[model samples]
Target chain A: MLDYPALAALAEIIRRGSFEAAAAALNVTPSAVSQRIKGLEERMGQVLIHRGPPARGTATGLRLMQHLDQVRLLEDTLDAALRPASGPATLRLAVNADSLATWFPPAMAALPVLYDLVLDDQDHARDGLRQGQVSAAISSDPEPVPGCDVLPLGAMRYLALATPDFLARHFPGGVTEPALRAAPAVIFNHKDGLQSRWVQKATGKRLHLPGHLIPASEPFARAVELGLGWGMIPEAMAAPRLRPLLPDLPLDVPLYWHVQRAMVPALTPLTAAIRKRAAADLRP
Target chain B: MLDYPALAALAEIIRRGSFEAAAAALNVTPSAVSQRIKGLEERMGQVLIHRGPPARGTATGLRLMQHLDQVRLLEDTLDAALRPASGPATLRLAVNADSLATWFPPAMAALPVLYDLVLDDQDHARDGLRQGQVSAAISSDPEPVPGCDVLPLGAMRYLALATPDFLARHFPGGVTEPALRAAPAVIFNHKDGLQSRWVQKATGKRLHLPGHLIPASEPFARAVELGLGWGMIPEAMAAPRLRPLLPDLPLDVPLYWHVQRAMVPALTPLTAAIRKRAAADLRP
Candidate 1:
């Protein structure tokens, strides 16, 4: 029996970072925001916010935020059921920058709703799904979350690429183990093994090479284009300026879409749209 | 006692995302990687990796990754002590996008090291430091972590701004709660409450407004520059194209640098450089 108004206030405070900001967003006085939170705390007998210049959620506050998210979803579902005129619902999703930058937006565009997108690596996105921070996720993980439905969305093809000048200077002998061993490579981050996998497959031997890592997707492609080092790029993201070194060396990374097992009817259209878009866009 | 080589192999596997890729990165065969991880697991008597199409670290493997980071730091310290000519050590840090886009890189440029940078929201950056996923973090947290020393880095001043056209169209009657409630605003993300804070300070009222959310820092600024909606922009990032709506309504967000209390001497220069640069660049 939590107070819905107070719970909304709690979520607003955590999201906006202060009672004052939450007050503004909710069209109430700062004192009102503080009072609601205090009332909620008194009822629960637990402190929800850690008082600071920019306030932070206590562990209890985090649990409350999650509850708010759940309540919002259920309320939206009920509203849709009661009125056909109810406007589109919001979807909070976890995605990667590369997907957001490339193919995912068009899929989402078909859905008529506000989107709260959290961008992170695919593995991290899966973690968010498991944590209930998001109702859905686009991830590299094929395994479904405990109460989620998983759909394979095909693969993003990455080609081993380098600028023309880099190829001429470093691999004049063509793609070989010795030459690759001596050349530097670009990576999304230390956790990226696409380049290493490509190198092993290309050279038929394991060889450690100096790595120049740039953590962002666009910068990584640009780093390769600028001749910082040879690396892999999604076929769709490969700048026109980049030329493939081993043109036939393509790595297909399979991606999956995971949706909550008990999804609301409002989201079915979105899932269909995503499935159709992914089928048309991703490499087989 | 753990085998250092096996531990290194385990870290590489987690970072690279696959045994084959780790093998290539370390100049060893896939069989060698498997053997090293197997031997390490047998000694520890716990599961390290969860096998799938791609492998992921079990919680134990994640702990091993943190241990790897610590061991690497200690080894670099020893190397520096034994030889003055040691190469620049790698420093893994989590930072806010605003700082990364502006003052922070120049601070790093003054240091002699390879960098592994993880960009996330400022509060989330602090969490990464707590999880031991990073060596240092630039955070909004004023208090230090249990074993960290905190330093004030002054404030990042942000101005609430809109294109002249947007201001004219949305607030022709001048800035007020009614107009604000009706007009759309841009936000870095749902979690970004900077705009809410500024609006309240400027309007002297609390009001919920429709929002246009873009998660990336550069894109969020660009959205403001493009007149998508009014939003707060860091003073340094405000392209000349953006004009301030309420010139006096500037928000000063105080920032802090949290460093491990037992920071090695090898990182002292970087810490000093960061402090000096922050002082020179940030508004006091």
Candidate 2:
């Protein structure tokens, strides 16, 4: 059996980013925190943490932290009352930027636990689950990671949008391939393919256009509204400030909720809330 | 001399992320694009592009691309005519999220070149310029990177804020150390030290509080507004919906614009606009 106190020290060091901070939180001395980590490392025969001003967990340390969380969650399930000693449980989840900006807060509000959110492109969020960095992820890929459940949440519709002035300046000849080639685009990131996919759907060709790479969802929409470039904006997030370039060709990216089979019980409330929100906010 | 056409092919392939996409952009056949890259790789005696479905440039490849950009920008400076063949020059920069969501758009509008922005914590954005991935960066660090010019851009005032209901629920006894320990925080990310710094300033203690990690600027502010947790919000972004937890103990983080000394002429318009915007938006 592992030392629960020592494990708690290790988890706190990783979470708070220093032995001193963890010691403060645990109401112990920094030397005691160091000694606990030293003993734990000796027993494990592996260097678990990288000692930085802001400390970080090694792969082994992170796995151990995850184990500690699982044990605490299981214990909490057995107990009827909240444990003030442990404080609130921290649940790490990977979610897309658009979801966090739009319909996701209700789901986050529904949960009692503290959250460690990893924001990534919707298509790439599954990597967080696959790599064991997160217990659950909101992904566009319908496929489930091993020992995980895939719940098909409806699709997020994205429209090719830009300011009316941008359209008038760049597409005076109409939205042709040549006009698109000349116009700048506002891309989310290298991982995001929504704009390119929408273009392929609209023009039946893959054309590379020079543009701005604005990774944040709100700023990306604002970039288009400010007439910097045309971009793909989520239907739920598309405001009146931007006009659609191709109203007829909307891209519906189907999303899924991927949760570890073991964590589903602990995450039931959040899952239920996500389902409720998605139903209202997404296209069926 | 290096083959400029082959170099253009390399830049296009890296920018577009595939040989076929590069071909589409350059108005050439995919095989011709492939041949050009093959010849360039042979001449350099190193692997340049990692051939994924979405291609990526190796470090040496990226350096060569940067050289190409510098040459083009220099030529554009000399000629004073926009070159339709090369398209608008793409300038890669690193910016803090808060600035991007608030005052940075006006500066972006003043420039004619396309932007590729890497959003990072203000404290860490300088790493992008140091690593040669970006020509310029907006950072809180006053120290300039080697061969870079640092322009002091004033400070962003941050207030410790939460919704009124959150303060009532968590701090019923008042904002004591114990109350702070019990109340949840809304942290921007693990790298963000504003909350910890503010706590130290207000209470003369570093309290490790459980919280939500919302990385995006707008969503992070929204999280506090939604009563998920309290966070250090930018003065420019603090909405009327959220109340200040400590109105007197505001944290002012000084920001600087770091640009490559060699690229100052190319970036003058952007620098002037950034200075003007910062003068209006940031605290003196």
Candidate 3:
């Protein structure tokens, strides 16, 4: 059998992408990470990592590492929940930009429980849970982790919006993928592909546009409202000022709540709280 | 604004927790869920659900409903490499037993991905993504979701195991909270927690008894193998197992998976092929 701790260290190195980075993340020396991976490989009787400047995982090593990742996550959640109270249970959570910008703040403010909030784009939030960084998470995935519980939060509606001026300048007449692609588009980040997906759905073609890449949540929304570019905005946020240039074209994405299975017992209160809150906040 | 779809109807009802599960889930059912909740309230809501579920937002409805679970996940993984496909690409995924055993499969597998695959018991399989989940997935979360794109795959892990021989001999050896509050223990779920949390770490109360729940992968490894007085397992399937051990102890519990958020684009032909194979063979 592999030395559990050493394997864990190796996995971390692979996860962090390099020995130095993994060491930095773990607050250990890179040499330690290197030794751990080397030891793990020798114990397993197989090479687990593909060494290079920026190291990668060998096939078998990657497989073992991935499995170790799951086991560790489950173990951590279970430990946190089952272990006696050391302090208030800190629920590390993730949320999307639009939700945080428009609705999450109120929900967070309303949360009666004490929690350590780690906010991020909804897409990135689940990563925290997988890495054993958080106990529970608000994710777009309704799917539960292996030993976890899942609650459906609901769908967040997205509307394609733009300031009257931006629309006039971009669309001129009617809105279509070609037109939108040609016009400058606003994105929370280059990774905000909702617009591209939307365009593809509308025109049956992929979008490869070069435009402004604003990297903040509130600012991204503001840029669009300020007539910087035409983009997809959450309906809840769009409800106030932004007009739906294309009403027929809308994007609706479902959301979910996932909690570690081991934490289920401890989660009763939290789940209840979240469910109650979701009941009041989400749109129909 | 988000696109509201009809498929979300049933899902929304369930999510909103009643006929009014949540309008956000239904997209067209706020009043519908309301009427449903109201009607159900007249019929069952009053009995099944409590009023003031949480807080209704500013004419926006459920404040919690505004939380987009999926978006949060996607955002976390947004930095990942784009899917190889042009249009709405299918996302192959990997997960574990606890997640599959719970309610998550439905929500995630139910989605209309271009293609999707879920690797079960991902505590050991996440490296498959080094092999790929098309784009991402739910795995035993540890370190980053791997490769830049990372997020929390919130779920829990539990330790529980038993064996026919052991049970026959022990017969409720401290089963309840007050009972075997001290006894032999087992930590079955593979690097999981049955012994550590419930016995030792939990308020420092030791099992003092004997035995260990050696973690196992599948059919042979469930709680029954170790003779631990019905250990903690994911709630989804634990109930059935408890049937045989009735009057002894209930073993159902929950676990979690912290997922990574790395997107290895399906750029290379080999990578693309593996992704395709994974989607076909791995999804639950």
Lowest summed lDDT window (length 10), candidate 1 chain A: A81-90
lDDT of 2 by residue, B1-284 (tens): 78877878888888767888788778899999899989999999999899986798987787777667767777667654554456778787888888888888878987788888878865456656665667889988888898889999999999999999999999888788888887889988777789988888889987777777788898899889889899999988898988888768899999899998888999999999999999999987
lDDT of 1 by residue, A170-199 (tens): 899998877887677877775676887887
Docking class of 3: incorrect
Candidate 1 vs candidate 2: which has greater TM-score? 2
Write one digit per residue (lDDT tens) for candidate 2, span A49-92: 99986799887887787777767766666656654456777787
Interface RMSD of each: 4.3, 1.8, 19.5
| Per-residue alpha-carbon lDDT of candidate 1 for residues B1-284, written as tens digits (9 for 90 to 100) | 66877877786676666898788767788999999999888988998888654677776776566566665566666644574442334466777767765677656645444456667776666666676666778876787787677889989889988889989998999888778876667777656778778877887765666675568666567656656678888898888877887767789988888776655454677778878878988888
Instruction: Give the TM-score ranking, best first.
Output: 2, 1, 3
All candidates: TM-score: 0.65, 0.92, 0.37
Give the per-residue lDDT of model 3 (tens digit) for B170-198. 55553443434333443332244344455
Deviation (Å) of B211 in candidate 2:
1.8
Q: Report how far off residue A232 is in candidate 3 (Å).
A: 1.7
Which segments of candidate 2 are over 4 A away from where they belong? A17-24, A27-47, A50-55, A80-84, A122-124, B1-58, B80-84, B122-124
Ranking by DockQ: 2, 1, 3
Candidate 3 residues A1-284, lDDT tens each? 55766766665565445677567545678898888877777777888787764466676665565455445434445555574332222244555545544544434323223233444555455555555545667766665666566788777777778888777777887776667656766655434668777777777876554344444444456557656566787775663767776778788777777776655665565567666666666654
Supply the global lDDT for candidate 3.
Answer: 0.48
